[model samples]
Structures are given as C-alpha cells and as structure tokens.
Target: MTESDHRAKLFGTDGIRGIANMEPMTVETCVRLGRSAAHVFKDGTHRHRILIGKDTRLSGYMLENALVAGICSMGVDVLLVGPLPTPGIAYVTRSLRADAGIVISASHNSYQDNGIKFFSRDGFKLGDDTEHEIEQLTFTGRIDDIRPTASEVGKATRIDDAGARYIEHVKRSFPNGMTLEGMKIVVDCAHGAAYKVGPWVFKELGAQTINIGVEPNGRNINVGVGSLHPEVAA
Candidate 1:
C-alpha cells in the first residue's frame, strides 16, 4: 500500500528471490538493488569496492551484469568471482577487503529461480537494519544525484583465482596432519556453484573421488542431482 510496505517485502530471509527474469529478480530490480547497495556501502575518499559471486544458473550472467552496471553507475568498483559458492563470496569479500559482497544464488532451488544476498566487509550477512537501509534507498529516489563522472566512475574486475582461494580455505579446516590419502569418496556438486571446485578439493587431498553433477549447463542444477538426489552419488 505504501513504499515502506513495498520495501518491507523486498527482501526475505535470504534476500530477494524469485523466478529468473521475473518480478523482483528481473534485471531492472537487480540494477536498483545494485545501486541501492552501492549507495549504502560507498564510504569516504577510498575507492569503494563490491564483490559479487554467483551460481551456475543461466540467468546468473544477466543478473550479474545488471548488478555490475548499477554498482558502477554509483562509482563503486566491482570484483566478480564468476561462480563461487555463497560462503566463498563472503570469504573472498573479506580477503579482498571489499566494502561489501553479493551472492547470486537460489540455494537448493531449481535453476529457474535465483536470489541476491549481501555481506558486510567483515564477511558476515548484513543485519536487518542494514538490509532495511538498502531497501529504503532502492525504493526512494535518494542518491540519484550522487553520480560520479569520467575518472570517478567505477570498473569491474574478474577474480580468476577466487575458486582456488576458496579451496585453500576449505582445506585448512581439515584436521591437522590429516589427509584423504587411501580414501575414496563420491562428490555430487548438483551442477551448482561447487561444480568446479568440489571434486578438486577431494582430489587435492589425495582422495580417489567419483564425481557426478559436475557438468552444469546452466539449466541442470538441482534437477535430479545434489542433496535432493543423494542416490546419484550413493
């Protein structure tokens, strides 16, 4: 009924989510979200940067680009880590000291659905108050005149080593002096974000890994694979 009501409904438990190319998940909404998030996190003199990561959904590319455009318009740099896991985005966001982080994913949802969530520089999810501020900025026409021009405009960079970095971080969590040597394991990536780095982690740890659901065609994620279909790996 009012802008406040609309803002209240914009984000959910895990951020804005919907069917790809529809309603809140559409490019327009993503652009606004990008702009709003950028405005919220863009701090003083230092060049502000936002890290963005995504899953294997086909629409991820479209939404990712839209977010980049919106963030750049606010004169904030964007670091894109292609298709890393959600937590990986948070890790890399802190590793790179970004002002904020974003993840484009729908978790266990079908590939047709996608979501956007954010993180603070501390690699933690933004509090409800922070999310509310972003929503408020998105619906209001505020920050419309804060545009930077020429050299002040932001740019985007692809973090090619993001996946490798995440793998290293995960490996560190293993018990000290422990290795997967002499062990065999099955890994089903569900054709999702971990598709690339999932098996790699096991293999690097000296395990004989039988990998499935590693080949994602952007539409096959979670379709008869992943935890939903544990039998595939079993």
Candidate 2:
C-alpha cells in the first residue's frame, strides 16, 4: 500500500542490489525489471515516459542497454542521462514530468557492485506492492507478452546536458556571500561518476585544486578512494 511497504517486500533497505553481473544486478534481471516497470505505469491518459540515470560503473553500459530494451518493449519511452549522480536523476525525473524514474548505481560500492533504484512520478520511491508486482512479473516470464504497437514503440534518447544542468543548479547552492578566491583544495573523485565534474566545481569556485583518483579503469572505482575510503586521500 505504501512505498515503504513495497520496498520492504521487493527491494532491500535500499533498492534491488547485488554484485555486478550477478544475481539481481544481472543483465537478464535488469531487462525483466524494466519491462515490469513499464507495464505497471501503462496508462491511456498520457504517453508513458521513464527517465533512467546511472553512476559510472563498468557494467553500467551493459545494464543500461538491457533496461532500455526491456522497457521499450512495453511501449515506455526512455530518456537516458548517462553517468549522472544519483540525485541528478531524481531532480530530472520530476522536472521532466516522466511517468517514472530509474537509477543504476551501487552508491559508494566498489566498481564490481551495482544496484537498481526506482522513483515515482512525484519524485518519490515506489511502494512494496508495486515493487513486488514488478518482480513477480519479471520472474513469471510475463514480460515478453506485453508488446507495444508500431505507433506505441518506445524511443530511447540521450540527455546530453544533464551534467551541465546539474552543475548550474548546484552552483546556486553556495552561500551568496561565499567565495573561494584563495583556497587550495585537493579533490579525490574516486574515479567514479564525478571524475570530471568534481574537480571542475573546485576550479570554478576559484580554488587552486589538485585532483586525484579521477581516472576510472572500470576496475578502480572505490578501490582505494572515494567517500568510503577517505584514507586514500591522505
């Protein structure tokens, strides 16, 4: 009945998560889950559109494609904002008036781990029944049965400016009277999604910024850096 209830039944304390390429995070599971989400949101009142975003993980590409394929099969259009921060997806989902939003991330996990989280049209999370329903639909093999008409086939489009858009918005959060004209800062980006933008923000604020851990080899995310292991910065 409530999103929390739905989450408790279908998702973990977080979202559906596991090691990358394993269990719930597998490509097959992502596809099935995407199809189920589309099915749950089908309505005659409006064209169904879903916004999907992901953090920078090596497996992100694989999961993104799988999810798009599955959701599209159910006639749900997908707007992809690749390699965005998790909160960025939440912001864009509500701003764009999409039917739903999904994120692929493990949120501070190592690169070998990943997860899937869902948000509602109102920019909240999905409920337990909703999550369970999707999981059931996925596991029951009912996903393939739901097909869109030629006119209804969903389209996938990339939102290339999401990062810049987020940056512009974040800049406004700084104190109006605050300026970083003479600060020297060392920024370690964990080689994750923030590799580019994190350092840029420091520079933009007029800080003498030194950036490290900005290189992601697909295997180095959170290996020895990031918020999870701040000791790496020392």
Error of 1 at 156 (Å): 0.4
TM-score, per-candidate, Cα-based: 0.97, 0.88
Report per-prediction Cα RMSD to one decimal: 1.3, 4.0
Candidate with top TM-score is: 1
What C-alpha lDDT does candidate 1 achieve relative to the native structure? Answer: 0.91
> What clash pairs does model 1 have?
none
Misplaced by over 4 Å in model 2 are 1-10, 141-144
For residues 101-207, could you state the per-residue lDDT of candidate 1 as single tens digits?
99999999999999999999999988999999998888888978888899888999999999999999999988889989999999999999999899999999899
Error of 2 at 128 (Å): 2.6
lDDT by residue (133-230, candidate 2, tens digit) is 88777777656766778988899999888777777667778888787889988898888777777877778777888788788877788777889878
